[model samples]
Target: MSAFPQPAQPSLFGDDGPLRDTREPVLMSLNPVYYDLIWAGEKTYEFRRRFLTGQSVRWYVYLTGPVGRLGAVIDLGPAVVDAPEQIAEIAERTRAGNGASVFEYVRDLDQAFAIPIQRVAEYPGMPLEQLRTELGGFHPPQGYTRLRNHPDLLSICEKVRADSVRREMTVPGH
Candidate 1:
C-alpha cells in the first residue's frame, strides 16, 4: 500500500462554510509565444493595466492556443503602476518582449502595470479537460480572477501543497 493516502474528493462546499479560503489563485491565459518566453525565464514582467489589481499574489499561468495547458505557477510581486513611458522602460530593461510593443498595448489605458514574477513551480502541461475536472468546470479568464471561492480549486491546492511538502522532505540518498 502507498504511504500517502488518496486525497478525498472535493465537494462544492467545505466544512467551514462556502469556500472562503484566503489564499487566492488567479488563472491567467497567455499566448504560446509569450508563454514560451516566460517559461524560458526570458521574460520577467507580465505587463497589464485593466486586469491587474495591484496586489502581490500567486498566479497560475495557463498556455492557451492549439496547445492549451496549465504550465506553471508564479509568485507575482506587487504591481508597479506607472506612466506608459516608464512602464515601457521597465519592460525594456528587464523583460524579453519589445518595449515598443508593450507601450503600444497599454498607451491608451490610464496606467500601465508590471507584475514581476518568481517561478515557484513548473508543472507538466495539464490539458483543458483535466483542468476542467480539477477546477470543477473551468473557463479561461479573459484577464484575471481570484479563485478565492472555488472549493474544487482550493482542494486541489491543498493536495498539491501536501505533495510538495512530501517531495521536499524526501532524502536524496534514500
Candidate 2:
C-alpha cells in the first residue's frame, strides 16, 4: 500500500447516537474516481495522465466541489474528483439527492460495501489542514478498526503518479 505524506483523519458521518455509525466516510481513490477530475481540469488530458501516474489525491471523505464543472482538489497528486452525472445518478435512484456521490453513498452504503477503509468523519467539508490537525494526535477510538493491516491493500502500479505531476508543475508548463 502506498502511504501518503499527510496523515489522514478518520472520516465521521453523523450526530452522536444510534444513527451515527451510518455516517462514516467511504474510502475511495484514483482507481474509481479518477476520470472525472481530469474532465474538469483546465488541462484535462495532462491532468488525466498525471492522476493515472499518482500525483493527485483525495482523502477518504473530504468534501470536493464540482460546481458547474469547477472541480475542487480532493486528491492532490493527480487530483481526483467526483463528477456531476455520477452524483445525479445516485440522487435519482435513491431519492437521496446525491446517491451517486461518494459523499452520499458513504453515509448510506451497507457495511458490506466498505472496501479499502471507512471512517466516521465530522463533515465532508473537513479541510486538509483540519484533518491533519485533528488526526495529528488522535489515538484510535473505541471499537474502531483500520484497513492498514495488510500492506498489499494498495499497490502503485507505476511511477506515473508522480512523474506526470512534476511534468505539469514545472515553470515551462505555465
Candidate 3:
C-alpha cells in the first residue's frame, strides 16, 4: 500500500547516471526506495498501513503469527523479502505453537520461493525465455503469480532491453 503506485519518474530518470550493474540475477527486490514526506514522517498512510494500524493486522500479520506474535522463523520463512530481524520474528512465532499462524506463514514463503524468477523482468529485459523455463513449457499462462508479486520485473525488463540500444550505439550499423 504505497502512497505511490508508480514513481513519478524512473529510478534512472535523473542523470545521477545509470548504475554500473553488469551482474546477472541482480536482485532488485532488496533495493530501497525513497519515501514521500508524509510517509517519511510516520503517517503510515500507505496500503501497508492497514496492518501497522489495528484496523487490520492480517495484511502483514503473517509475520506476527496467530495469538499475537509467535516466533521469528514461522514469520520469516514466508517472507520473500524482509529483514533478518523480521525473519527471526517469524521463526520465533513458529516455536510458539500457533497452528493457524504457522500454516499461513509457511504457505506464503513457498509461494514466494516458487515464484518463476523470469517474471522479475519485463518485455524488453524480462528474461522471457528464462520465465518460460522456470514456468515450465512454452508460453506461460496469463496472471502468473511470478508476474503478480514481482512488479519490479517490468522495470528490470525494460532496462535490459536498453542493452541492444547500447550495443547498437557502439557497433557499426549494417
Q: 1-174 in candidate 3: lDDT tens per residue?
A: 788796455355453324432222212221012112111322111111001111111111101112221011001111133433343344344333333433344444422111111111111223335544543533322221132244554333334444432111111111
Candidate 1: Cα lDDT at 112? 84
Q: What's the best-to-worst order under TM-score?
A: 1, 2, 3
Q: Give the worst 10-residue stretch by lDDT in candidate 3.
A: 69-78
lDDT of 1 by residue, 34-142 (tens): 7666656567778886655646676776778787776566667777888898889888887545788999989988788887775446555467888788766877778
TM values, all candidates: 0.69, 0.20, 0.17
Compared with the true structure, model 3 gives a TM-score of 0.17
lDDT of 1: 0.67
Q: Kindly report which residue pairs in candidate 1 clash with one another.
A: none
| Backbone clash pairs in model 2 (N, Cα, C under 3 Å; residues 3+ apart or in different chains), count | 24
Off by over 4 Å in 1: 1-23, 51-54, 134-136, 157-174
What is the per-residue lDDT of model 2 for residues 1-174, given as tens digits with 9 covering 90 to 100?
A: 667675544446544445433322113323224333333332122111111222222333223333112012222233233343433343344333334443443343222121111111121233334434544632212222222432221111111122222112211111
By lDDT, is 1 or 2 better? 1
Best candidate according to lDDT: 1
lDDT of 1 at 135: 69
| lDDT of model 2 at position 9 | 47
Separate clash counts for every candidate: 0, 24, 26
As a whole number from 0 to 100, the lDDT of residue 81 in candidate 1 is: 86
lDDT assessment of candidate 2: 0.27
